[model samples]
Target chain A: MSEQAGYVPVVGAVAEPQPAPEKSYRFSEQAIQELEEILTHYPDKKSAILPALWIAQREYDGYLPPQAIQEVADRLERPFVEVEGVATFYTMYNLRKRGRHHLEVCTCLTCAVMGAYEVVHHLEKRLGVKVGQTTSDGEFTLSEVECLNYCGAATVVQVGDKYFGNITKENVDELIETLRNSNEFTPADLANAIVRLHIPERTAKK
Target chain B: MAETLVLLKHRDVPGIENIDIYEQHGGYAGLKKALAMERDAVINEIKTSGLRGRGGAGFPAWIKWSGIPKDTKKPHYVLCNADEGEPGTFKDRELMLKLPHMVIEGMIIAAYATQSAKGYIYIRGEFVESARSIRRAIDQAYKKGYLGKSICGKEGFDFDLYIHMGAGSYECGEESALMSSLMGERGQPRLKFPHAPLPIHEGVWQSPTLINNVETYAAASQILAHGGAWYATMGTENSKGTKIISVSGHVKKPGNYEVELGYPVLDMIELAGGVTGGKLKAVIPGGSSVPIIPAELCKDFKLDYDAHQVVQYSMRTMRLPVVGSGGFMVFNDKTDIVVLMRRTAEFYTHESCGKCTPCREGTRWIFKILSRITTGGGLPGDIDLLVNICDQIDGRSYCGLGDAAAWPIMGAIKHFRHEFEYWIEHKRSPVGEDCLPPAPEPLNPLLTLTPV
Candidate 1:
């Protein structure tokens, strides 16, 4: 994740000319309605960019592809570059596709002293992939994240919307096994949960 | 001193997240009390409570509440900073998870006092479960006439609350950066006061805005329910009331403990079941941002905002530690100060918003030097170089993130200079071969294996 530092969008770089792909829209009817409802929560349509990107992430299968950025830009009446910049600034909006479950291990100060690296190594060995790589079977994507702020349960691992705490090198296998048998789309579920939080129950019922 | 239970009084009760359970336990009484009185009286209650901001920096809460304009020329807004990104701090997570109504009730009271018709709680994206609890509480509050038009049968008083979730960015925790994020821009900060108007004057689409931490709002509700003078009876002279300290690392029973402000530091450690695994080496009294204090010096301080005064006597005191956001982390004998500082540097480096040069370049340089020292590539003048870089970034950045990045490194070098000198002299940790945080391994073996 440190590799994402000092990020500056490339401007005016020359490249071989290629035909632009035909633009397509992928947001479902419910997603459009949810985005409209979220817009009402804010004073303007541009304030809905973050939640709109979440709707896009769920519609595009857990990551923000180029078309997803374009769709969000078109919906919010903002420029593509403006939407792209906002999307990349945040860490949770994935630009690339992830596996079935995104396993983010906390490796900050308290977690490091509590042996978070050993848990990372154990997961790396079991998953047969390094940090930031998805397994060949697309079952899991492992990454070392910053603190989840649940340091009381140091060495916490966040799988989608849930945080699994008190994790150690020995007990991580059980979490992986549990994730293996589940059929939920963890990343999309995370995005959906965040989107639902923005809509009030009364508004949703309407 | 024993743990005080004010905000966490009914934390252990089952179904307290539900509105009925919360009201049964004397919740919403604060809102009812606030609604009956004049708006200025509500603000006066908070002023008398002697409560300071719990999100850190200990600013008086009443000043911000009273700063909102009385005449409603534009729509006034109230915000709750639920983006808890401090490393060892999870008190807000538990407060929202268990006592959502406390936070909502406080926000409602703030809205009434500030004459704000609409409010938004900007929660972090990672805390979906906590946000769901708040969402349920808000829905229930509406059903009971605690929200929406003419809240709680108070004629012509209308307030609406909404939750706005943030994408991942630690810079957004800063108040101005939070406002920028709330306005749907990049999560970078704007220029602060003196050069620019304060947020109270112009914020959130150029309207008067009042923003407080989750704990601060929760504490506000308590101060209004039980009179301010009654709540001000606890703690030291300068700091009053109880603070929830999130105790983590090397402690036996690591969790959130609410204690009076002036409680002794050592007593707080014992309250969390003492240091585990080995004798105590040091304690990061607050979150990762504050200065680290050696175990010997820990006895002199108390858990209050003024605890930083002790650091004035230290030899190389460029920074001081406060009861900041209450992230009390304890370290045992096996921990390595140099490695710990390296991880701390890496965090600030990754989270720097890159809006300022001193922070953007300096944090990366600090991390690079520390990474080289830890990976067996130390130079003779590297310690001085680290100090120079920290000095450059200390007060030079746009936000406190830069200052936060510099404090712990300087503090570790001030107290444990020998550990850094040992690493420079002999390219290994002075603690042992088996330090708590071992040296870094190449993240991807394939990249290292490939021919250059």
Candidate 2:
């Protein structure tokens, strides 16, 4: 069953009653192009709003500002509330300021067995921030999640889609150091070379 | 493209999830094929193919579809269960987002098989992108003569599909609750089994209806085109066709693993880099509602639906029977099994809907006591109290969710008494320290991407 493009006019895909604000996320043409490429996957551009929001959140320090939300809304031709609803629905998506770096500690089974409680407690003590709270220096936001699905590596964290697998308190300091000196690194360097990224989403290994 | 199963077969074919690419890949062939067949042949093929519901129950698809008698002569309706409220489950969302047309096409095929024209996609509210995609895809089908009016060039056959966003209730994942929500009612679990009164024979708007999971509908398209035997060959005996297992929790590589039905859970673990240092303690093979069996025990556990049932039903001496929600929640050695039970108990307590008192207030009492005990605020008799509370909630609610909610606490206490005692006595989870890695280095500022 082949679907023809531009068949039914989407309520927001083409135009909306009110316009959105101009984008000012310090996003480069290259990043915007990358996002544009992703949006092309759908017949209606509005379908890309979630991934667009994810990209925007990453660019804006884990939270999407009203303008950031509007930018994605406008890009997808969807109502601003529609985009906002999505940004707020997922616990993972941040719409407010977190830390300079986001550390999501998975406390599910494998890592829990490996003393993930210690990792969580240590991070809480070390960073002096409770889960969901950012460090005073704004360098880190420590959060506990149900599972990151990498129990094999237990004690995992995603500092922006990059998986740091099989973590421990000993490696916590090094991970923090890496974040502090992130200026010298590229994500290609830190994403647990073990688990590949969500590129093309769900491209699982055989 | 009208409809294409992109995520299911996207890698094998380009433009599979993409509208333009899907169109180029000869995507809507199934719909065209479906329209050409007499709806009876379509139904019979699904019947013979041995397609099972992708939803946890794994019921026979054709039998469920055929429940509605054609001779009754009532209006036929079709529903797509895209509510996808299962935790640790994002496969439906991913598939819908990637290939909206595929689901649309699948819905069309299922509608034809069940002899229903009007359909609704009841999607979870959290799936914003999926909703948008399905909505857009339906609009695309309508524009292309794929969704509305007549099918391809067929007569006396027309289909209409609508996407209704959910109100953020996990309980709505149940088909009956989903029906209630679609009818615009608050999603409170019904204690009584609303007898499967042949929905296809008589359903929504009081017509015969066929309701299928998004994946099942997609598979219907495949079976309609490739034939029953071809479709049956891909899966295991008793349970034919592949299954999309959402491997979450503690796996190194967490995501959807689409495999032939009989693949072992161990294979899925290795697929996830051998469970992050191989310290997997226990796993909730289905979902949190499913009992947490030791990971070591699950090594030989077959991922097939029937095999899992056998192992969990007969082998595992559970107090309550398992419900079929394919939510694989992994627990590592570091997890405070007892505390985890407390959290789950609390969720069931808070979400019980209270239609039945035994479940309504009973769940809450257990959760409160379990929480206090886990946090080191328990009285001496709390463990027995917790067990008693579980007993009260089990089989005492209006819906299976009550028993489903109580299973884990009762089972965990039965299996891991020491962990619970440790938490009660020490006021801490035996899970020790959380071993999660520290935050990674921020994106290089010079690299032009700022940290969020």
Candidate 3:
């Protein structure tokens, strides 16, 4: 039964060894200025780590590479291990390479009970890859993440920066095509293209 | 159906996101009113209002503010926990996205009450739209003199607020973990007692800090404007005022609803357009971390904090308290209990912060056992194995997150033992057979599989 369902426990699995970096990296001028502006908010420079990581990740394609992590630590005047530790602790900071389109499907309770697993299955079937696996063409990486705080729209799927709630298999297909064919595609652009996809509901109002 | 619009009064208003529009609707009136009154009088009013923290702990808000000593030589700070990462919860996200000023106004008033010159709103990284909206609001606030020195034209009354983003750690929702993360360390909770002072006495950067939920601060602003007694008139004896509930899962309409305390949970579901399939199987009254109450037990369920005190059928063995953060999730008849329990354990295991051994090991062990049980590899005594693991992780763990990680296993086994038993006997999940896609939809060459 264990093998039949493709469910394998991550425990006892040997972790892949990370290769040492080949080159050192530094924050760009703009990112350095942004970091300085961010530092003014906190009493100490260390508090800027989270935002610094965000900037570094953006500078070096969506994921935080080892070089980028080291650069962030150097800029913030922190030890290498300390910055890496902070980076690995948070889920949003992807250490390994991710596809150009990272699709985070919320499979937590609210989304789960509302058939988010079915959406996961749909993506696996459509993309011919399982969760945590990127498509062979280096276009999409599918992961079943925890809640992204849009519980009202069950089965919420986040692509790039924008979120699409009330996702169905049909909508998922359209999402794949939209990302697959777009020339200039960020979540903000995708949000405008799929504005009508999410049905806004009545919330607490006067 | 008591539509009290204290916190969410301007939620649906289109232009309320604008500072000027918000001010037109009596938005910052609370902060102004609180600022005009004496500091002690402001504190006394909140104390009289009986407001509690909405961030799962439910600690009294006024007591936390009053704990800050006036004579402290160090600067005081106020922090708002806007990292709405708890499973099945998104109330704070909605509040921040729709009405950013109200939450910020609440923070200013709270900073004033606690005598803090600085504040921070630690928002989660996934909330891109929320963070952008709030950044715009913060900029607007500074320009309007709501944030910088000489606030509201009162000389020597200076306050500064900043919004910091957490990369993405659920444990950062814990107050101490939040502080550690803010200091660029691993987002793990510190050993509070037997070591250091309470955060209110000594917190971030060794200064007395006051940390409250976004909703709590939003409620504080309203309490100041309308007067404590007016806010106190709603809800039960102790749990006064309205609560913004984020209702989701197997409902005809799933969304956030602002309902007064002591209202029936069933009524809130109805307001959410009733159950999806016309049958309600269970309701996690708080967030997913709370015990799952079966449908029958929810007949008398109310929306207040005390309402959560009425122990359901699952509370026979493990009597856990329910000071939930208003993440009301409803499960329908088609839902598989065992699968939900497995997923819940997996979330905790993934988010265990690896600080203490009990949670780090126990959460993963519970998930492994559940995974085996669901996959037909369960031993006959797997039920006892789960209960025993939960017993160790419940109280012996370092933080509430560990205890929270343990309760669902106890509750699911206590109430839905038959579901686990069925999986073990049949060697597969009862619902897993129907839930999986039929024949994988015949993948084409364009979507070739390369199993990792």
Candidate 4:
């Protein structure tokens, strides 16, 4: 059954303060265009929910607030509950405020055996916060995540969207310092790393 | 004892990622072969190859394609399950990253076999590089007339292919959940047995959808070009062709290695340059879901569908031999069994979709107990309680995730009960005596785009 996407404004029963209707969330023109193009790939507009949430999260500063979720649901012509259900099911979507940089350490079996726990302990001790807490300055949030699927490079860590594999206590400290000073790690750096690691000298064929 | 590189063949060739280079290296030869044949003949060719689903289930691929009703009025959809989130399994990601078109070529041929007009490559969201690579390949395929209207310039063979990015859900690797996610719903798995319709009969907006993992599609592409009979000549009985094992964890060289089925587990370890420390202590032959095998028991083990043999124990009835998704993880003696189990429990706990009761509640309960035990709060009967809880989750949960969550706990308890006992008795982890060296920093973690 197709769900209707019509909006219903909530008039708070015990309101301290409420935003005006004009303050409703909307994606930037570029994002909306990106979403529109994404919609063309799917037979049903609903299939674009995951990517739509990605666009919304990137636009709304690394987390899907209620407004962002509702805006996505409204724009995609899907029900809010459906959008929320999809959002909550995935681990990547931050429901609440995360830090400027979120460090997700892969603590699954491969990474764990490769000393992922030590990295977690090191980060927690270094950052003065537990696994899921952000620093007081709102700069970092440390989380132990399930497999990031880069098993060849065990003990992988993701800062924003960039992935650093074979992470150790030393590298973790370096990565934290780099993220602290820089707002973004350029894609060029990541691309160069992938090419270098993946392209080794020709070897004997199996 | 040599590695067999069927799927990874020519994968390391410079510029092989490009369609033109890919074609020059005999890439689209499979699709050309498939398109030239009668559709059923193509399916029969795959059937003859004896290729099983490389996604972990080991189900025969051709039979799965042929299961869809031949005369259904609704359009069939082929889904390429590139959601490679299973812990320790990065074969699909590497396959796609190195050979995106090979995977695409597999999907194109699979689409032809199933008579599907539209296909979706559902890649995991974290693979930013792979998603871009596959997108480029799809565009190139369209330009070269291998996809879209009148595929390969055959007048009536029209097919449309699109890439759908998954927003990080391990459960989406389950076929039913994958279809549900593709339909824009939460990626929780729908009930499969007893009542719910199979994806082949009623999937994705109630249309017959054929979904196969990326490795399966890549294998299928090869099978088409080489012919089923030729492909069948590789492996042992039942488990045909070469399997790519994503070997990681406590090994000297951890990476994806392709070997013919029935290759000895000991040889695989040797191929990986052996254990990191002393000798191997244990092995999680499949992904983290299957039970771990003690190194002693691994002596006669082979890398095949039914290679693992459960040792005799009173609780052995629950254990089954599994080659789940080919995520082979080796562990050395220095590894802490309790901590490993704790991490395993935490993973299922964090990933449990909360759809059904047992998995939701059971996983959390186990995780909490594990957390307590690892932190020195373990009680006397905590082992029994953990085992009992795992039994409950394993027996009645909605999907395979429940069984997966149950397996490692049972395996650890069965094999390494002393480790748990030491933790409970001494109020400390047994691993305190054997400190592992810090992991080596990745040589190159990021990859820049190579111009096509």
Candidate 1, residues A92-124, lDDT tens digits: the string is 999999999999899988999998988987888
Give residue B38's error in model 1 in angstroms: 1.0
Model 2 TM-score, all chains together:
0.66
lDDT of 4 by residue, A10-70 (tens): 6675567644234387687766766776677677888878778877776776677778888
| Residue B294 miss distance in model 1 (angstroms) | 0.3
lDDT of 3 by residue, B1-452 (tens): 74567788888889788899999999889999998998888988898888989988777899988889876499999999988888888899988888999899998998887778888888887887887678778878888889989899988778988777787789999999999888778899987866768998878998999999999998998999889999889888988888888888888878788888787877877888888864888888788788887788777778777754422332334456453888989888777788788778878887888998989999888888887776668889998888878877776766788889988777777678888899888887666565322212223321111111
Candidate with the larger TM-score of 1 and 4: 1
Best by lDDT: 1
Per-prediction DockQ, in order? 0.47, 0.04, 0.30, 0.31
Sorted by lDDT (best first), the order is: 1, 4, 3, 2
Q: What docking tier does model 1 reach?
A: acceptable
The per-model lDDT (C-alpha) reads 0.89, 0.64, 0.79, 0.80
Runs in model 2 deviating more than 4 A are A1-206, B1-7, B11-14, B71-74, B191-202, B308-323, B379-381, B435-452
State how far residue A58 of model 2 sits from its true place (Å): 25
What are the chain B TM-scores of all models?
Answer: 0.96, 0.87, 0.93, 0.94
User: Candidate 3 - CAPRI tier?
Assistant: acceptable
The better-scoring model by TM-score among 1 and 2 is: 1
Best by DockQ: 1
- Model 3, range A1-206, lDDT digits (tens) per residue? 24658766688687876785655675666556666766777888888787788777767766677898888888889887888988888877778777878788887888776677788888998998877788999888887788888988988998877788998766889888988897543422322221111111111011
